[model samples]
Target: MNEIVRIDNLSFRYMQGLDNALEKVNLGFEKGAVIGITGPAGAGKSTLLSCINGVIPHYMNGDLQGHVLVNNQEVANLTFGQLAPIVGTVFQDVDFQTVSITVEEEVAFGPENIAIDPAEIENRIIHALESTHITTLRRRAISTLSGGQKQRVAIAAVLSTLPDLLLLDEPTSELDPIGTQEVFEAIFELNKTLGMTVIIVSQKVENLIDCDRIIVLSDGKVAFDGQPRKVFMRSQRLAEVGIAIPEVTAFIIALHKKLGQPISTERLPLSIGEAQTTLENILRQYGVLS
Candidate 1:
């Protein structure tokens, strides 16, 4: 698999402070994989995402060390104008990213700023709107949309530039359940169909249950990096770092301990359907179901 992002001994510290915000972090993300970053509030999750887009040392005053490479180019050496095309960022607050009144113009803003041809910008606007399933709202004012709709517009805006890697900071934080599902579905489609590499920093682990991998951060360092199942099964460690597993996975663990069943934590289920299947199998073995 092609590497989309690579971090080597990356460390950063606020100029006004004495402690490091990120310390000696090392990781690699491949194309077409959905990776999740989770930790406590002060664990530097957002700072890590910002580094991918060159926001740390570029937009903010900070002391930085090590390297963050996107598409094999170091972020520290790239300008926002040069990085915009390859790495698109969706901030936690969608309202902060909006720049146009209508959805169509908002989606076209980035391409326009980059001097893309008018015809090509129009084509990209339509494609992004359709990709995000917000084509019907293209003509609507940005203020009139709900929180979820606003976030969809923000994503469409980024997609208009056709970025190879997407860095999302809690994209579904403010959406309702239905809206959250819509956003996740769109992300899933992009990863599976368009082969877009995604790295999301989120507090809600339930939304990341299907991610290809999960990375847990604590005290500005990587605590765990592995498959979702492995991370979820390490409930004690996750809790220690202020991270939570999917509720269904927690339920399965509780049930297994209470029933004294030979439940393998390695195959822990992340979704309700998988949990149901596991429960049924356990019941059958106990002669409660046949």
Candidate 2:
């Protein structure tokens, strides 16, 4: 598959820093894929997303090397306004995202800013709300919505611009369980159904279990980059880098050690239902259950 976003030998340092915030970080992302980025604090995760949005070398001066490409266009060469149509970045705080008083007005803001035709803007508003599963919240006051609803509103606002790529930094960090679930559901719909490419930066590993790929950064370098199961399989290495495996995966790993079963790492569970099935099979094998 062609890479929608590609980084090659990318290294950078803020003007005041001695070390690069990102070092030799070569990576690629596919269209319509949900890619998760996670790592310890100060691992340069946020810095990476900033590059794509033309924040580095523009507003923030830095020594840099190599390059980043979004939609095959060199990111550094593009101005922020130039990149706005191609990329949309949503931050963790919904408060910063909500400019309009109501959901419909907020969703319409992106397209309106670009001076989209009036009828077209209306259609985009409708599509964005429906895609995010927030059509019912369309006329509701932004202040009246829950945190999860507000987050979805932020996403819908970005979606109205019809950007080629979506960057979410800690989109669900401040959310409760239900809020988190709601955001992921919208993410899945955008990727799985609407074929939108999304990259999420978050430390919450459990929420990323369903992602197509996960990349772990450490000290400005890639420590792990693979599908969730394989990366989480090396729980010890992850822990060394101050990253944690999902709770269910950790449980299965511990169970294998305690039972001396020598289970395959790939057999470890990522979800609770998978854990249940795996546990039952182990019980049967041990004659502990019929």
Per-model CA lDDT versus the true structure? 0.88, 0.87
Q: What is the lDDT of residue 23 in candidate 2?
A: 94
lDDT of 1 by residue, 1-290 (tens): 58989999999998886899999999999988999998888898988998889888798888889999998999989999899888899998788889899998899999998899999999988888887778999999999998888988998898788778988898877778887887788778888888988898888888887899999989899999998998888898899888878888999998988977645656799999999999898889889999
**Top candidate when judged by TM-score against the true structure:** 1
For candidate 2, report its TM-score: 0.90
- Please provide the root mean square deviation of candidate 2 (C-alpha atoms, Å): 2.2
lDDT of 1 at 262: 45
True-structure lDDT of candidate 1: 0.88
Off by over 4 Å in 2: 95-102, 130-149
Cα lDDT for residue 108, model 1? 90
lDDT for residue 42 in candidate 2, whole number 0-100 = 90
- At residue 30, give the lDDT of candidate 1: 92
Each model's Cα RMSD: 1.7, 2.2
Off by over 4 Å in 1: none
The TM-score values for the models, in the order shown, are 0.94, 0.90
